[model samples]
Target: MSTVVQDRSSAGPLLAKTAIVTGAARRLGSHIALALARHGANVVIHYHRSASQAAQLARQMTQLGVRAWTIQADLADAAQVEALAARSIEASGGVDILINNASFWPEDTIWDMTAQTLQTCMDVHVMAPVILARALARQQREGHIINILDTRVTDYDHKHISYHLAKRTLHTITRILALELAPRVAINAVAPGLILPPDGYGTEYLARLASTNPMNRYGQPEDVVEAVLFLLRSRFITGQVIYVDGGFHMRHQLYV
Candidate 1:
C-alpha cells in the first residue's frame, strides 16, 4: 500500500470565503478541500459519480466549523461546467478560488488509442479548465484559479501519449490565462509526482516508481497542498508551474 501522511495542524478561519474544487470526492481533491476548509474557506465539493463521497466530504468540512456543499457535474460537459460556476456564485455570493483538479487518465499505446479517448482527455484536461477560467473571469470579481497538472509535463512519457498531450495543452492554457486574467485573478499550476499512484495502479508498481525519484520516496498529498497554499496566498506570483515532485524531475533518465 502507498504511504499516507496527515497534517493535524490547527488553522485560522478563512472567515467565510468560498472555493470550488472540481472532483473533490476522493484522493487529492479531497485533501485540497479539507486543507482550504481547515483554514476557514467554505468549499463547494464537485463530483460526477462520487455523490456519496462528495456528501461525506461536505459533512466533514461542516464539522470543521464552516459552510460546505456538494455539486454534481460532469466537467466534460460544457453546460454542466457553466452551471457549476453559476451555482457556486449563487450559493457563496462569489467564488474566491477555483481548483481544477478533476481529470481522466487512461492508458493506451499510440496505435491502440482511439479518437474518442484522445478527445475525452483533451475535453476534461484542456477545454474544461479554459472554459471554467473564462466564465470565472467574466464575473468581474477578483479570484484565483489553480490547475492541477502532472509532473510528466516537464519530462515527457511516451507511454501515455494522449494523456500527456492533453496535460501539455493545459500547461499552455495556464500560461495564456495567467496573462489574460492578469492583475485580477491569478492562474497557476501544481504539478504533483508520485503523490498517489494513478487509480488502479498496484502497490508494488508504485513502490518501484517511488524509488526512481531523487528523494527515493513518494510525495504526500500534503506536499502538493502546501505548494497550493503558497500560490494562493502569494499576491505576487502568477503563471508559474510549481513542481511538488520530490525532485523526481531533476534527475535524468535513470536507466540510460
Candidate 2:
C-alpha cells in the first residue's frame, strides 16, 4: 500500500482561496485536495465517472473545515473541458489554484499505439489543462497553475509511448504558458516518479525498484505534494519543473 497523508494540519497557508484539482476523487489526487483544504483553501474536486468517490472526497475535505465541491466532466471531450473551466470559475467566483493532476495512463508500445489512443492522451493530459489555463487567463484570475507531469516524460518508457508523448508535450506547454500568462498568473510543473506502486502491489514492489534511482529508494505522495506547496508559496517561481522523484529523472536512458 502507498503511504498516506492524513488531514490533520491546522495551518492556513491558503486561507480564503479556492483551488480546482483535477482527478481529485481518489489516490494521490485525493491526498492533494485534502492537503490544500487543510491549508484553508476551498477545493473543487473534479472527476469523470467516479461520481460517488468524488462526492465522498468532497465531504471529507469539507470536514477539514474548508469549502469543497465536486464537478464531473469527461476530460477527453473538448467541450466538457471548456465547461469544466467555466463552471468552476462561476462556482468558485475565481479559482486561485489549478492542479492538472488527472491522468490516463495505459501501456501501448510505439509500434502498436493507435491514433485514437494518442488523441485521447493529448486531449486529457494536454488540451484540458491548456483550456483551463486559458480560461483562467481570460477571466484575469491571478494565481498559480501547477501541472502534474511524470518523470517518464523523457521517453524512458517505450511501453507507454502515447502517454509519454502527451506528457512531453505538456512539459513544453507549461513553459510556453508561463511566458504567455506572466506576472498575473504563474505556471509550473511537478514531475513525480515511483511515488506509488501499482494496484495489488505492496512495499516490496517499490523496494525492488530502489536501485533504479540515484537515491536508491522510492518516495511517497506527500513528497510530491510538498514540492507543489513550495511552488505555490512563491510568486516568482514560474515555468519551472520540480522533480519529486528521488532523483530518478536524472538517470539517463533512451526508450527503455
Candidate 3:
C-alpha cells in the first residue's frame, strides 16, 4: 500500500457546497466564513448574540456571489445547537461543511476557576462541537468539519485553566471523531496562536509580543482561514491538526 494518497485535484472549488460556521459574527470565525464564500461555497453564519454583525457579514458574503444566511443559536445550549444544525440544513439543502469555531475565552486562574466557569467552557467548546458533529454525521454527507482549537493545547495556560482544558479536550475529540466518522466526514482541527487578541486587547498588545514567536510577528485571522481551506480541500486527510500559530506550537513552554 502506498503511503501517498490519491490525487487531490479532484476536490476542486467549493461551489455547490454549503458551509455552516459558528460564532461567525466576528473575529476569526468571521474570516473563515468569508473565505468559504469567496471560494464559492454558500455560507451559513452562526452567531450567539451578535445579530447585527452576523447580518452584516451575510450581506458581504452575498456580494461575493454565494448564498449566505445568518442564523442565531446559542451553541452552549444543546437544544440551540440542534436547531442550528437543522436550520443550516434547511437553509441550504444539505451541509457540506461545518466549522465549529464558536468559543469564549475568559481570563481565569486556578484561584478563580469556579465549577460554573469550567462547565461553561466545556458547554461551548466541547459539548456544542460534539453535538454539531453528531448532527453532521447523521446527514450521511461527504464533508469537512474543522474544530478551531488553540496552540496552547500543546503546552498549557495556567492563567486560563478552563479554556485550556476544554480546548485540549476538543483536540482529542477531533482526532477520535475523525476515526469514528471515517470515510464520510473528514474531521480536523486548526490550532491558532496569537492570531487575534483575546477580547479586550488591542493591536498594540499583540505587537508587544510579536517577536516572541519564531515568525517574529503576530498572525492574522487570514492565516488560520487558509489553513482551514487547505484541510477542507484535502480529500484524504483527516484527524490532523494544522498549527496556524507560526512556530509557537513547536516550542512548548515547559517552564510554564
What's the CA error at residue 165 for candidate 3, in Å?
0.4
The Cα error of candidate 3 at residue 38, in Å, is: 0.6
lDDT of 3 by residue, 54-159 (tens): 9999888776767889999887788998998888888788998999999888889999899998999999999999988988889997989999999889887999
Q: What value does the lDDT take at residue 162 in candidate 2? A: 88
Worst 10 residues of 1 by lDDT: 1-10
Q: Which has the better lDDT: candidate 1, or candidate 3?
A: 3
Cα deviation of 196 in candidate 3 (Å)? 1.4
Clashing pairs in 2: none
Alpha-carbon lDDT, every model? 0.85, 0.87, 0.87
lDDT of 2 at 130: 95
- Candidate 2: stretches off by over 4 Å: 1-13, 253-256
lDDT of 1 by residue, 1-256 (tens): 2111122244332446689999999999999998888777889999989999999998888777778889998877888988988888898888888899998988877778889888988988988888878878988878889999998897777788889899999999999999999989999999998888777786666688887778888888999999988888888889999988877767676545
In order of appearance, the predictions have TM-scores of: 0.91, 0.92, 0.92
lDDT of 2 by residue, 1-256 (tens): 3122233354444776889999999888988888888777889999998899999988777666678889999999999999998889888888989999999988899799999999999999999999999988887768899999998875367988889999999999999999999989999999998988876789899899988888888999999889988898886889999998877776875214
Candidate 3 accuracy as lDDT: 0.87
lDDT of 3 at 217: 86
In model 2, what lDDT does residue 151 have? 88
